[model samples]
Target: MTIILAWYRDLIELTMSSNLMTMVQPGAFSNLIQIGVLNLRLNNLTTIKSDSNSITNIQSGAILNLPKMRELNLQSNQITDIRPGTFSNLPNLPRLRLSSNHITNIWPGAFSSLPQLRWLDMCSNQLTYIQADAFSNLPQLSYLNLASNQIATIPPDTFLDLPQLMKLVLLNNPWQCDCRMVAFSLSSAEMLTNTIK
Candidate 1:
């Protein structure tokens, strides 16, 4: 952990060659020099601790301020609600993975600031709703995965803005499978598949 702190303090890429880090000390790497990519996959991080080393609440700015950051991996955590502005500062981030977490709701504008974003994985979570225009500004987004979530109803024209989107995975969501949902499914590429309830 000390080495990880030293490397991170130098604005270096933090790669996880192993999944053994179960405890994270806060105030560890919030002010690292200029990191570009942060990969903390397969770790045991439950809550992203604050910068005070006192196990404080997760602060969105901790990861957002890494200016050169292009990719962030928080997969397989216990994260639930994603507060607004959590991703507002990651302008250069392109790939974000939050798969297999405990996420429930994605508030409005939760992902509106990512212009270069392409691949986003929020699959296998506890999400049940998607607000209108929740993904309006993601013009460059190509792949999105909302599979295995608890989603029930998806509004009309929910994906009208994602024209270039190629792969959309809605499998395992307990949809109502009504006429409106049927039409919404039609707009998606044939490559996109949804499980029927």
Candidate 2:
């Protein structure tokens, strides 16, 4: 269902948390052009993509038409997958919170839309494996939280493209500590130590 917010032209922040929203049609917020912060946490959203085939003619994602958005909160939802172009509209977005979801897979280039994104929180999810290029194309990312997931091992070059990354939280995962994890662990240890210092 489309939420018509065309009258509130000067609206900046919109909070619709804990509303039991199942799905948001594409261009749901197309009228909220000046909006910066959108909080849709604690919903029952399974997938951000709408069921309409017309979405292909527009944008293929949950959030659309909000160009000025900086912070998006979609935590505590039932989201399972993050497909490519899911966030293709929010170029200026800086922070995204997807924690406490049922996310198991993140398609490649899922986050390539947010060029200015700096902070990403994906803690407390069901993520088991992450592709090496999953986190690529994020030049301004600094803080990433992947704690409390089911991930055991990730590729050594998983964080290679994130030059500005200063903090990475990977705690609470059942790590294997095998040869494949040696390089990543050593580098992560150094990064964590430097962050502490």
Candidate 3:
């Protein structure tokens, strides 16, 4: 029985890391594997699960086979955009890292299916605008980072729907501190005293 359990664990791990076509050992199966973790960081991937209309051939189902995948690290790539419903099937996805990419825009409902997602890291990108209601359905999201982008202004109600969000980072953005910013400054000053310092 112990040997059987060990084999099961090995199979699970193998399934999770199967989508990575980089450096797997010989005789490895690469599909329908349900590994708990999938880390494909720092690869030369220019797109994330692209589609037929996409210029790149990386389609949506590229990582769709790993159903048990809970965490995915796709940092330091050249991803420019994320199609809506790109990760609709991966129900257990809890954490996603997409930092250090070239993303410029995020379509609404793009991250809507990630019901269990708690943390999202999207720092160090070229994002100039975030469409309204982009994160409206993320009820379980707690930590979100939108730092180090080209964002100059935040649209009204852009963050109002995120009631469950506990920690949000909006630093390194060249914010235009005008009347709109004054309202934010006053509200932030009153809510979090650290804003004064």
Candidate 4:
């Protein structure tokens, strides 16, 4: 994936690097803080290495920098999990794209840092399990795309704090819309109805 992919026409530091850890580090992207956007989409970023040289599947502390970063593009990768505080430093980040990955699980408090985030695209993944209130930190989130996944059921109170949520795309999933999901169905219907207005 190409890091520091800016929003304008010109790209920065275009390279074919495979290892996500060795990207101008052990400095850890300290020079990319001035850029407005970063597009690391479409690559073989399979693992992210911690400061102590420990190997892991999720890229957390490795990307905690970039205070001015607004949009981040990580679409189409091999990420299967999201640990907590992976993005705690980027509080101003608004849009995050994570579509078409292999993410099956997102730990609780994983996105607690994104308070100003607006759009989150987690569509077309292998997500089957998400902890309750996993998205509680996103107080200003508007659009959420969870379409085309293995989601069989969404636990109640999952989206309780998302009052400003505009669109929720849950199409093409194996939803067990039974009585146990009364609250989920009702809230989803209400969210949609509110969106129409």
Candidate 5:
């Protein structure tokens, strides 16, 4: 469905949760220049791009023209894949919630555009593996939650890009107790120690 918010030029927050929306046409929020918070939780959104059929594959310019966007909530959806440049349009977004979705894979550069993001929640998803650069380019990201997923192991440098990351939650996952896990544990401890200093 097309969401024409042209009349609400000065709108700051818009919540379209539980709307059962399957698709959102491009330029849906083009006129909401002052918008900061957008909540699209509990929807049937398979793809953020009108031309795509995959879940959560947000192509560039799909939801563009929101220069002031800060918080975006897409929880409890059928999102499975987080393609690269998904949030390229929301440059100023800080907090993103993708919990309780069907997310299985996070491609490289998926969050490359969100330079100012601080908080990210991906709990209760189907994430099994994450690329090393999936969370790259987010220099300001500090908090990350990956609880209740099917992840078994992660790349050693999976979080190497997040220099400011302070909190990382990975509870309820099938983590393997191998050398990789040992390395990750040591690195994480070091990062936390630095953050505390």
Candidate 6:
């Protein structure tokens, strides 16, 4: 605990001085609502927060107070689960990176608050299932990368709300090219066409 506390305190000093922010925990910056960019990449973190750490564990409504946070990087962690609406507090968040994790499922409304989200990277994950309308909240989303995942099928209306999507990457997945898939592929093509033209 002392080591973690020292690390957390160092992060605050570095961030306040406008130097570089890394290896920092979310609870460490919970009170800094207007922080512009936060990067916690390659931290080997498994959970969003832990209750034992008094200085950095997120309290209730602590995340919601961060109304001005824009970019967050949590890539290369051991994160496996994302509680629904956990990210729904950052309505102004634009860029989010969750690549190279063990995420296998995405709960519905997981990104509901990120109305300004532009880029979302979930590559190199174990994602095999995504709840319906899981991405419906990100209406302004543009770039999405789901490459190197375990996705076998894409459900209907999975991307209905991503009207502003510019680039989509779904490569390297074991797609089950069956009847439903054929139909889904055709429908996806149509949807893309409609979105483009």
Q: Pick the candidate with the highest TM-score.
A: 5
Model 6 pairs whose backbones collide:
none
Order by TM-score, highest first: 5, 2, 6, 4, 1, 3
Instruction: Determine which window of 10 residues in candidate 2 has minimal summed lDDT.
Output: 50-59
Q: How accurate is candidate 4 locally (lDDT)?
A: 0.70
- Candidate 2 local accuracy as lDDT? 0.80
Candidate achieving higher TM-score, 5 or 6: 5
Q: Candidate 4: misplaced stretches above 4 Å? A: 1-27, 50-56, 189-197
Model 2 TM-score, all chains together? 0.87
Instruction: Tell me which residue pairs clash in candidate 5.
Output: none
How displaced is residue 35 in candidate 1, in Å? 1.7
Give lDDT per model, in order: 0.68, 0.80, 0.63, 0.70, 0.82, 0.67
| Candidate 1 local lDDT, residue 161 | 74
Which candidate has the top score in lDDT?
5
Q: What is the TM-score of each candidate against the true structure?
A: 0.76, 0.87, 0.73, 0.80, 0.91, 0.80
Query: Which ranges of candidate 3 are over 4 A from the true structure?
Result: 1-30, 50-59, 180-197
Clashing pairs in 1: none
Candidate 4 per-residue lDDT, tens place, 78-188, comes to: 667788877777889899988887888989988898999999999999998667867978989999899999998887768767877877888999988788689777877
Task: Give the per-residue lDDT of model 3 (tens digit) for 1-197.
Answer: 01122244344442122133322221122343556665656655554442111111133444554567778776665667776776666677889887887788877877887888889999998888777777767878888999999988776656655656778899999888787666555654454454234
Give every collision pair in model 4: none
TM-score of 6: 0.80
CA shift at 96, candidate 3, in angstroms?
Answer: 0.4
Alpha carbon lDDT at 166, candidate 2: 86
